[model samples]
Structures are given as C-alpha cells and as structure tokens.
Target: MTGLHERHLAVSPDWLALYYRHPLELTHGEGRHVWDADGNRYLDFFGGILTTMTAHALPEVTKAVSEQAGRIIHSSTLYLNRPMVELAERVAALSGIPDARVFFTTSGTEANDTALLLATAHRGSNQILAMRNSYHGRSFSAVSITGNRSWSTTSLSPLQTLYVHGGVRTRGPYAELSDERFIKACVADLEDLLGHTRGVAALIAEPVQGVGGFTAPPDGLYAAFREVLDRHGILWISDEVQTGWGRTGDHFWGWQAHASSGPPDILTFAKGIGNGMSIGGVVARADVMNCLDANSISTFGGSPVTMAAGLANLSYLLEHDLQGNARRVGGLLIERLRAVGAGSPAVREVRGRGLMIGIELVRPGTDEADPDRAAAVLEAARAGGLLIGKGGGHNTSVLRIAPPLSLTVAEAEEGAEILGQALHTAT
Candidate 1:
C-alpha cells in the first residue's frame, strides 16, 4: 500500500470505506476531471458524493473563499455576518416555504438533526415517519430516521421512527404494479401505518434516495402522501442533501417533482450549496422555526468563508444555467448508458432523472444483487481513468453516476465509453 493509504487505514475508522482495491488520493482537480497523487487524471463522475455541484476548482467560488478568508473566517453566530445573512436570504427565497426561516449548520447530519429538533419541538412529539430504503445523514438523530439497514448501524434511537414503504419502485412488493397503483398502495400503507401511531412530528424523506442507490418512487408518490400527512397535522420534511440545487436536473429541488402538493413543511439541504465548503441548512415556515422556546446557535454553521463560497457557487450555478446543462447532457448520457447496459446480462436497470443516475448489477439471469461484481466494476472503471461510486439498499450492488452539473456532452460521452468498457471487463 502507499504510505498515505497505510496512514489512512491506521487513523480512519474501520467502517469508513474507501473506493477501489487500492484507494486513490486525489491531489487536485479542474472542470470535470481530478488527478491522483501519482499524477493520473480521471473523470470524476461521482463528484465527491455529489458535493462538487458546479465544477472542480471553480474560479468564482475560489475567489470568494479567498477574499472572505482574508477578511474574516468566522465570527460565530453572536456577531452580524453579512455573507451569512445574504446566503440565507437567497436560500429562503428559493426554499418555497411561506414566510421561511433559515438555520445554517456545518454538515448535512447537523442540518437534519436541527430539522428533527425543530419538527419534534413544533409538534410536541418525538415520533417520526420515514421512508424505507431512505438515508438522511449520519448523526444520532439522522440515523434514527434512516431506514436503510446497511447504513442504520444501531437500533437505539432518541425518537420513535416508523419506517413506511414506497421509496424503491423496482425491488419491493409493489414493483409489478403500475405507477398509479404504486402511488395508491404507498398512500394506503402510509394511512394504515398512521392509524397505529399518534402525534407524529414529521415525515422525513429524500425525493431521490441517495445512499439507497439513486432509487426513487413515482413522481407523485410524495404528493399523495402529503394529503394524508396534512390530515394528521404531520410536518413533511424533505431531505435534499443529494437531490437539491438542480443536481436532479429536471427540477431545481427534487420536491418540485411532487409539486401537486406544493412544498414540504421543512426542507434540509447540504452537500453542494457551497460546492466543496461545509454548508448545510434547514428552511422552515417562520412559525415552525420560532416554535423553539430556547435560543440555539451553530458555531461553525454559517462561517463567513463558507457562506461566501455558497453565494459564489449559487451565483455561478444560476448565471451559467448549469441545471440546463445537466438536463441536456444527462439525457444523452443516460441514453448512451442504457444502450450499453442492454447487452450486459448482469445489468438490471439504468435509472434516474437528470444528472443523478444508477445502474444496478445482479447475477446473470437472476434477481440476486451482485455486490462483488459492482466492486469489480468500480475497480475496473478507475483502471480506465474514470471515478464512479456504488450504493444499494441491502448491498452495494448499484453503480452510481452523479457528475457535476456543469458536465459537457463530450465529457459525458467519454465517461460513458470508459464505463461501458469497465462494466464489460469487470464482468
């Protein structure tokens, strides 16, 4: 192993997984490509788990961070922070919550934790409803609401979490049902589950299940659930950590796909807003936000440097219309990938909207997941100068492709070609 790899193994937790048989140490990046410490360049399809929203080494974001660092790195939440306020304003305006209030955090875990806090306090209940095969974050509270067995490490939790169905449309019992019937069944399941509970604070879900291998329900599944949650006075919390800020391409926010019910009562976002900086936040109705009787603050949540990066990143994303690029290029990439998958017996599905895509791997002519093959494909892809990621519900059997929103058509096609070779070689 390399010296850095040996050192990482010594210092990192056993559960902190790394990609490839020999993990790579990326030294620097530009545009859609990154270079390893050994001077090999690769197309970064996973975007560091979708955190690099715009592109690698974006000049606008770098300049903002540098300028802000020169002035002030952080003043805590005690002092007036202009950049924090400005970024919050932009986020609030876009959050779609009426009379919205925004609270910043340092990571997606903290953001979800704050959302759960707000939700339970507002409703005076510690009961939460979550979708099966869903992943929110990695905090104690966040994990409590998580339904993915692979990610939910412990059974003990602070809240009473009820796992509902309908996150994955392709593997569950409802897979054979039509889209309309699937929505109806999930809604019925939700209503039935609620009949056995009381004082549910909120229903937290990802419009697109990220760690669950990019799986999603029918477009209106959440909209259908919204009607039931409203009757029970339960808040709907949309965890947009992976699907937020135009990453999904077709919509600025993934929740917009279920626009029939309007916005959620609360929305939590992270990963991409600040490009690579640490920035996560919760947006809620003013009344729900103020429901907390005690004052709370995040020390490193809205640091000036991070907020400046977020503002610059957001400006660049909007001005350049990266979302449009994601739609156009991602469409072609998915089509190309689907064509490639058509000939592979191990390939089960190529699914997603916009830039977020997943390719499931299974044993040839069988329904069983092939996590071993998935890992091999990951290694092969890296060997071919492409960096992708993997995730699934019960096992790591799906290849995830979520490049930066600014990916060009040429880059997409090149990456697809490399990936096709990887899939075949690994098989």
Candidate 2:
C-alpha cells in the first residue's frame, strides 16, 4: 500500500496543516502494533491516547460491527433499538449501578456536555466547580470548566469559575500544600466558592488527571469532595473519559479506586467504551436522569452498529480478563521503569496506576525545569521503532506509555528496552 505521506505530498490540500499529526501515516493496526502506509511496523504504546484499551481491530468488535451494519446502521431517536437497550443494560450491570440509565453521544465531549446539562437541570443553577489542570472536553460548556487555557480561548464569563489549584506540582502558590493539605484546601475552596453563590449546581473532575500528565491526587480526595458537595447539595460529576473501562487495572471503573468513599452522582465515560467506534455515554443515578423528558434525544447517539460494537467490546473484555492483564502488566512495567529511574539524574519522578504511566524528566540544574533531553529521548524512541506521547504543563516531559491491554509481556519488555536505549542515546 502507498503511504499516506506519499499520497499527501502528491495531492493533499494545504488545510491539513491545521492539525498536528505524526509524519508517518498509519495504514492498519492489529493488537498492539500499527503499520505505516509504507509497511513499516511500530509498537503502539500510546494506544490512541489510551482509547484502544482492548487493542486495534479486535476480532469480536469487527464481527459485531459488520453484522450490525448489515442489519441496520442508524435510526431516529424517536424509535427504540434492541442493540441500544441491550448495550445500556450491560453497561449498567457492569458499572454496579442496577438502576442506572444511559444517555449516549458520539464523543466524550458530547457526553460531558450532556452530563453538565443534566447536573444544572437537576439543581437549576449555573455555577460549576472543577479542579486545576483537569480536562473534561472541548465543547463550550465542557471547555468552560476545563482549567487549561491552551485548549480554550474564549474568555470565561462570570458565571463560571474554573478552579485552578490542587494538582501535582512542586512550585507555585499551591506548593506549600501537602497531599492531605491539598485535598482539604480543595474542599475549602469549593465551600468558599459556594458560600456566596446560591444553588451551586455541580462539581466535575477527572478521577486521575489525564492530559494534565496522568497525575493522581492524594487518597480520600474524592470522598472529601463528595462530602462537601453533599453538604452543599451539589452533584459530583466524575469525568472518566480517559480513565474508565479498566485502564486503571485495579478496578473496572476508575472511580472505584475511591470506593471507600461514595460514588459520583453522575459519571461520563468514553475513549475505550466502543473500542474506537466513536461512542460515549453519560451514566447517571436513576433519580437524576429521570428529570429528562421523553422528548430529549440524540439523532445518532445509540445507533445499532455502535451499540453492537460496544457490546462485543465489553464481552471480549470480560471473557479475556483484559482488566486483570492491565493490572498485572502495568504493575510490572511501572516497577521496571522505577528501577530504571533509580540511578538516572534526568528522571525526576515516575507515577501512574495500571497501564497509564508517566515519566517526568528534569534537567541537571536546580531550576526544576523540564529537560529538553526528554524530547530528544522521544525522538530517539520513535526512530528506534517505538512511539510515545509527551504531556503536562511545561509539556512536563513525560513519556506516556499506555499500551493496549492485550499487549504481551514480551512486547512490553521490548518497548521498555527500546525506551532505555532511547534514553541512553538522548543523554
């Protein structure tokens, strides 16, 4: 097959530059690997921003999508579909919420928008509280709550106060706060913000900050926040767009990491739910979802094909015990990475749970700045047949290694070896 780079060079339009993409064009993918248009193979540790938890081109998902496409692709929301109902039931059952009701959307952004709307509707309030360095989505309402200004340019109106504190950083005004102090401060901030504002509607946050460099906050953070929200009569929204569906190894739902506390009033999930089929959902408490009228609908949210794909994906995950694999393999990978970092001056920190891992790189000086050597390390890794991602505020120089759950031990070791080689080469 001809490479997309070659074809683009010959005939592609100039508008393609609007988006930043890898120079290589992928032609196909299977399991934990992808082939460039030129047939060069590369191990995919990135996993489409951690969306392909079960891996690319899964057999069962492909068969389900094909069969459903043959039967029916889409229908108006005014009509009911068997596949949609079945998928919803399975999701509710797996999520441990027997009376859960689902509202589907085509992407995580839409799912977030739906969740925010539902929360505001239930409380009839406009004020929302969110954590700093947290990412919900890119839509108008979702972006309004996002703490990153790079992703959003529109000036936030007075109605929204995107809280910007209590994340993983050693410097700044928040540096004085320890993990426990930070959690307490977050709760205090929410309470103070809600004091003057009557009828504060909801508070939304990611269980583990993803785009903010996979930072996991202190333990009991969720429970403390949940308590504050309950006291103020506000809904707690869990944005599981990246952490949901077994990527976090220890639990099926990333929020389960905080099971000692209480569950969120509303949960939004996407990324891996449809195994790359572009499906997302808002799973809310039965009472909260009941406020929506029967007339509320999405034209293509729960189409038969996407529903079938979702069912097949979930079934495969359960049958193969991919979540167990994620936990075991991810633990092994983290141990090895930590060992590698033990003696390396360039590595500032290693953090993550399950398959979601990040390695923070720091310079040799006392400035505590991101080491450009880490960027060179990633370039070297790509040249050495491995692909990784960089993230965090300074682009904090993290090597994001979130491979498919189906990735084998041998493949994981090989990728790590290449990363080691890349690190040495860059140094």
Candidate 3:
C-alpha cells in the first residue's frame, strides 16, 4: 500500500470505505475530469457521489466562497445573516410547498432529522413509514428510517420506523407487474399496512433511491400512495438529497413527477445545492415548520461562505440551464450504456433518469447479483482512466453513473466507451 493509504487506514475508521484496491489520491479536478497524485487524469463519472452538481472547480461558486470568506465566514445564527436569508428565500420560493419555510442544516442527515422532529411534533406521533432499500443518511435518526440493511448500523432508534414496498422497481414482489398495476399494488399494500397501524407521523421516501442502486418505482406510485396517506392525514416527506435541484432532468424536483398529488408536505435537500459546499436544508409548510415548540437553530448551518457558494452555484445552474443539459446529455449516455450492456451477460439492468444511471450486474444467465464482477468493473474502469461508483441494496452489484450536470455529449460518449471496455475486460 502507498504511504498515504497506510496513513489513511491508520487514522480513518475501518467502516469508512475507499474505492479502488490501491486508492488513487485525486490531486485536483476541472470540469468533468480529475487528476491523481500520479498526474494521471480520469473522467469523473460519480461527481463525488452527486455532490458536484455544476462541475468541478466551478468558477462562480469558488469566487462566491472566496469573496464571502474575505468578508465573513460565519457569524452564528444569533444575528441576521443576509446570505442565509437570501438563500432561504430562494429555496423557499423554488420549493413548491405552499407557505414554505426553509431551515438550513450542515448535512442531509441533519436535514432529515429536523424533518422527523417536525413531523413527529406536528402529528403527535413517533411512527414513520420508510421504503424498502431506501437510504436517507448516516445519523442515528436518519439510519432509523433507512431501510437498507447494509447502511443501518444499529437496531436501536428513537422513532418507530416501518419499512414499506415500492422504492425499488425490480427484484420485488411487484416487479413483474405493469407500471399501472405496480402503482396499484403498491398503493394497496400501503393501505393495508396503514390499516393495522395508527398515528403515523409521516411517510419519507426518495423519488429515486440513490444508495439503493438508483432503483425507483413507477412514476406515479408515490402519487397513489399520497391518496392513501391523505386519508390518514400522514405528512409526506420527500428526501431529495440525491434527486433534488434538477438532477432528475425532466422535473426540477423528483416529487414533481408525482404532481397529481400536489407537493410533498416536507422536502429535504443537500448534495449539489452548493456544488461541493456543505449545505443541507428542509423546506416545509409554514405550519409544520412552526410546529416545533422550542426554538431551534443551526450554529454552522447557512454560514456566509456556504450560503454564498449556494447562491452563486444555484444561479449558475439556473442560468446555464444545466437541467436541460442533463436531459440531453444524460439521454445520450443512458442509451449508449444500454447499448454497451446489451452484449454483456453480467449486466442485468441499466436504468435511471437524467444523469443518475445505474447498471445492475448479475451472474451470467442467473438472477443472482454479481457484486464481485461489479467491483472488478469499477477497478477496470479506473485503470482505463474513467472513474465510477457502485451501490446496491443487494451487495453493491450496481454501477452508479452520476456525472456532473454540465457534462458534454462528447464526455458522455467517451465515458460510455471506457465503461464498455471495462465491462468487457472485467466481466
């Protein structure tokens, strides 16, 4: 192992995983590419797990952070902060929730924690409904609602969380059903689940399950669930940490795909709003937000530097119409990857929307997941000067591809070619 790797292993927690067998230290990044400490450049397909929304080293966000830091990095939440208020106003306006109130946090975990606090307090219930194979975050409360066994570290939790169906479209009891029927079955299952329970605080779900290997149900499944939830007066919390801010392409927010049910009662977002800056927040209806009895404040949330980065990053994203770019480029990339997967026996599925795509690997002619083959492909891709990510509810057998929203068509094609070669050689 490299000296740096040895040192990292010595200092970092064993549970904290690294990518390649011989981890490459990335020295710097520009646009869609990054260079290793060896000065070898590789195309970045994962975008730091979808946190680099616009691009690497985006000038606008860097300048904003630099300028803001020159003035004031933070002043705590006790005083009136202009950048925080400005960012909150922008987010609240963009969030479809009527009379929305935005509360900033440092990470998606904290954001979801706040959401749970709001829902439980507002409804006077500690019960929450989460989707199977769903991953929200890593905190105690976040893990409580996370249904992914690989991610949940402990069984002990503060809230009663019940796992539900339909987060994953395939490998489930309803996978064989048609989209319409799938929605119907999921709704029926939800209704049945709720019939046996009472005083549920909320139903939290990701429109596209990110760490669950980008699996998702039919577009309107959540809308159908909304009908059942409304009957119980259960608030819906959309965990948009991975699917928010136009990452899904067709819609500004993933929840919009289920617009027939109107906006979610609460929406939490992180990853990508500030590009690489640490920024997370929850947007809820005014009543739900104000429902908290005691005053709550985030000391480092919405700090001047991060808020400035968020504002500039958001502005650049909107101005450049990166959403449209993601749609066009992502469409080309998925089709190219589907073509690549067509001849590979190891590939069981290639599915996603926008820049968020996943290629599920399986044993040849078998339904069983091939996590070993997936890891091999990841290493081979890196050796071939392409970087990608892997995730799955079933042993991390899925190749996750979430490039920057500003990816060019040429970059997508290049990435596909490299990925094809990696799959061919490795699997």
lDDT, candidate 2, equals: 0.79
For every candidate structure, what is the RMSD over all alpha carbons to the true structure, in angstroms? 0.7, 2.9, 0.7
* Candidate 3 ranges beyond 4 A from true positions: none
For candidate 1, list the clashing residue pairs, or say none.
none
The TM-score obtained by model 3 is: 0.99
**lDDT tens digits, residue span 1-427, model 3:** 9999999999999999999899989999999999999999999999889999999999999999999999998888998999999999999999989999999999998999999999999999999999999999998999999898889999999999998999988888999999998888888889889989999999999999999999988888889899899989999999999999998899999999999999999999999997889999999999999998888777999899999999999999999999999889999999999999998999999999999999999999999999999999999999899999999999999999999999999999999999999999997
lDDT of 2 by residue, 120-182 (tens): 888878788887777777778887887765455467643465473555545446566887777
Worst window of 10 by summed lDDT in candidate 3: 292-301
Query: Which pairs in model 3 have colliding backbones?
Result: none
256: Cα error in model 1, Å = 0.4
Q: For each candidate, what is the lDDT?
A: 0.94, 0.79, 0.94
